[model samples]
Target: MDLIIRKYGGTSVGSIEKIKKIAQKTKDDINNNKKILIVVSAMGNSTDELLEKANQISKSPNQRELDLLMSSGEIISSTLLSMALQEIGVQSKSLTGFQAGIDTNTIYGQAEIQSINNDRIINEIKKGNTLVIAGFQGFNENLEITTLGRGGSDTTAVAIAASLKASVCEIYTDVKGIYTADPRIVKNAKKLDFLAYEDMLELANFGAKMHPRSIELGMYYKIPLIIKSSNDQEDGTLVCNSKDIKNLINKGIIMNNITENRNRVSGVTSEGNISKITLKNIPDKPGIAAKVFEPLSVSGINVDVIVQNISNKNKTDLTFTIDDKDFDKTIKTLEKESLKIKYESIMSGKDYGKISIIGSGIQNAPGYAAKFFDTLSKINVNIEMITTSDIRITCLIKNDDLDKALIKVHEVFELDK
Candidate 1:
């Protein structure tokens, strides 16, 4: 039987009614003779509520215990969904990540999946039982429970699909599909029918609908991933490598024969809660860069969009962006290492967010950049820090102007058509 891997996000399985709806969908899949294995996230806000309860007990809970406590949310979801499936006359079984043979590294909060043994999963499927595995978690080498950080459920789903060699991975979320811009913000934002893996990777990296690691897993495994809506049976979006793209690209893009917007760019994505930290007046030297960033790296804080000013008088300034969640931790870590790094002072701000446009052949074609900047210029939004890959251009702007800038850019790039 051809196997299919489907993952439902927390919002998709938020209520008993929603779970029943999903069960019905599963029944339809089975009726069509496709072997479907599901991965499920915790019910909506359950993980956050659990974290809040833990915070009520202690400001800094033990990492190991925190992972153990947080993992229960997904277990609850998996079990509940399995019960729903059974009640609806679908034979199904729920398994924790470990029970499904997912093993990870020792990191408690953000463990990396090391391997997955397909023996139990295969056996359960062979017995005609659909497997519903808890997402976002696994066990470490020491057999301790570990969570996969923020986007862990997506990671779990994709990793499992890759490990089991499933035909394709479907990510069912609240949104209809990947859009030209967030449909909530840009009213005219159009849904993209297909995306190259590289383009999607850029989007994921710059705060699109996906987690970078999950997209990376999909790209590396060569698994075709579809992002679809759980609330309706809409053709959401297909993300795959270029070779598998349907039809041929005419005029730098193709969108299932949609001719209104034919451009190299795919989408506009935005993110808030950005914090930029600058180490001012650092002694311009060979190893200063390492000294500045090494501490943040060791602390597992993600730093993005780095900039180094020109050296003058044997001193220079270094700036980088990170998610504001790590602001306090980043400050403390840098302050602790300030003397060693020998920076004059630290300047930080929480007033910034990023807006980005991602697509294909951006560097090779200069018009995209000119148009992007011109669009922002017209809105009078000042760009702070700028970062780019061949397929993406990201600009940090004042949070106040983020919405207008994103919408204007969407219109300017013709992504709304």
Candidate 2:
């Protein structure tokens, strides 16, 4: 039998009522004679709640213990889902990450999945059982449990799908597929029916709802993923290769986008809670940046949008941005190596946000950058820093102006149309 991988996010199975509905949906799929492997995240905000509890106990809870505590949230949802399935007269069983044979590296909080031994999963499928496997948490080399951090469940679902070589992976979330701009912020943001993996990856990296890592896995594995709302009947968006079968269903959605002008720019995205840090008066020598950032690299802090001022008197200023959560960690890391880095001063601020335009080769094409800059200028939004890739153009600006900036740029490009 052909196998399908269906992943329900935390909100999708948050309550008893929703879990029962999911149980019914599973029954419907089984009635159609299709086998499914269900992957699930923790219910509602249980993971956050658990983390809050850990914080109450100790400000710095041990990483291994924290992983242990957080894994319980997913375990609760998976077991409840399996019980609901069984109560509805369906043959189903719940499995934790270890039970599901997901092996990862030694990292406790953000472990990378090394491999997945799906022998047990295959056996369960052979016995006509629908397995409700917990997402996010997995085992390390020594059998210690680990959790994949931030968007971990989505990563887990895609990784499992790739390992099984399943037909497709369906990710059910609260949103009705991907949008041209954030619907909550921009009321008229359009729902995309399909997207090229590259376009989706850029959008997600900038500010789209789905995680970039999940999109990356799908792109690398050539796995077709459907992202849709679990709460309603809205159509889902499929992310896959542009040359995939979607061209047959919606031939012009991506192919003739530029010529038709319906979607001149594929989407606009904005991300807040960013902190920009600048190291002033450093020697303008090669490898100076490497020396300064190596500690942060070792600490796994993601740095973006590096800008170096021209050398004056053989000294230059270096600036970069990172997520707000890592602001203190990065500051301390730099300070600890202050003598080695030999910088004059540290300047940092938390009032920054990034606004980006994403599409198929929009960055490479002329005039898109001009249109973006012009639109922001009319709104009095000053661009602090700018970065570009083959398909994305990003601008760092004041956090307060992100909403207005996104709307104006979306309108300028006619993405809502």
Candidate 3:
């Protein structure tokens, strides 16, 4: 029997009616002779509501307690879905993260999955029962409940699929598939039928809905992942290795040669929750860069898009971007090291956003950067910082101009077509 794993987002199981609909879908799958495992996220905005309730009680809720509280959302959804399935005459079982044997590190919030003991999952499958596992929450070495951060459920689904060696992992979301740009932001943005895992990873990291860790796990295990919408029967995007994609194109199943030059530009993405910090007049000495970033790293703050200017009079300026939520913590960390680092001044700006274009071999493509900058120039948008990789080019711009920049850039690359 073929084993299949399907993951539904919160919106998919937001209400009783939707849960019933999912029950019908699962019944159909069971009748098709496929052993099914379902991973469900918390229903609707319940997780957010939980956080709001916690904040109402305390300014800084304890991380361990917050994880335990937040994990209940998925548990509620999973159990409800299981009951819905049984009510519809299909045998099913609901299991929490710990019950399913998801082991992780000791981190309370943002814990990484260390391993999964699939014995229990296999036992349920052997009984011809549909297993509905709660997503995002896992147990640490100490057996304490820990929650994966944002998009953690996606990670959970992929990790389970990998461990079980399932045929494929399906991620059902609100959108039909991954697009060249956010469809709402670019009216003409086109849906990509397939994507290389590397491209998908870049897109997710820059701000796409799919999680980067999920993509990374999928890539590592060579698992095929499909992203589609639960509300509709439309085909979703397939993410896999480039070689696998090439085989599909050669088979004529995919009409467009995604590996070709015309399709070189994969997508344009923008992240608005970004802030830049600058340390001015720092002594440009050996190990200065290390000294400046080590504290932020220790504080669990991710610094991105760093640029250090050439030394002038043995001094230079260092600037970097971080997520808005970590800005205050980053500032605090830097201040504590001020005496040790001896910087002239520290300045931070929260009105910045990053726009990135992702594709394969983009760095080798002549005039791509020129065309990118030229398009922005035509719209009078100023670029603050520039960063690039073999497959992506990112630019920092004012948050106020993000929408305009995205639209113009999407058009320039003709991604809408």
Which is the leading candidate under lDDT?
A: 3
C-alpha RMSD values across all candidates: 3.3, 3.0, 2.5
What TM-score, over all chains together, does every model reach?
Answer: 0.95, 0.95, 0.95
Count the clashes in each prediction. Answer: 0, 0, 0
Taking the tens digit of each residue's C-alpha lDDT, what string does model 2 give over 183-231?
9999999888778898999988888878898999999998888888898
What tens-digit string does per-residue lDDT give for candidate 3 at 1-417?
Answer: 556789999999899899999999989967867577999999999999999999999999999999999999999999999999999899999999999999999888888999999899989888877999999999998889999888889999999999998867889898998999988888998888888898999999998879899999999999878888999877678888767766545643334555422478899999997999999999999999889999888787878899988889999999999999998899999999998889999989997999999998686679899999999999999999999988999999999999999999999888876
Q: Write model 1 residue lDDT over 1-417, tens digit each, in one string.
A: 556799999999999899989998899978977689999999999999999999999999999999999999999989998998999899999999989989999988989999998799989998989889999999998999999998899999999889888777889999988888889999998888778788888888877888989999999998878898999877678888656654333311223542322467888899998999999999998988999889999899998899999999999999999998999999999999988999999999996899998878677787887788889988798989888888888899988899999888988878765
Which is superior by lDDT, 2 or 3? 3
Candidate 2 clashing pairs?
A: none
TM-score of 2: 0.95
lDDT of 3: 0.89
**lDDT score for candidate 1 against the true structure:** 0.88
Error of 1 at 112 (Å): 0.8
lDDT (0-100) at residue 196 of candidate 3?
86
| Candidate 3 ranges beyond 4 A from true positions | 245-262
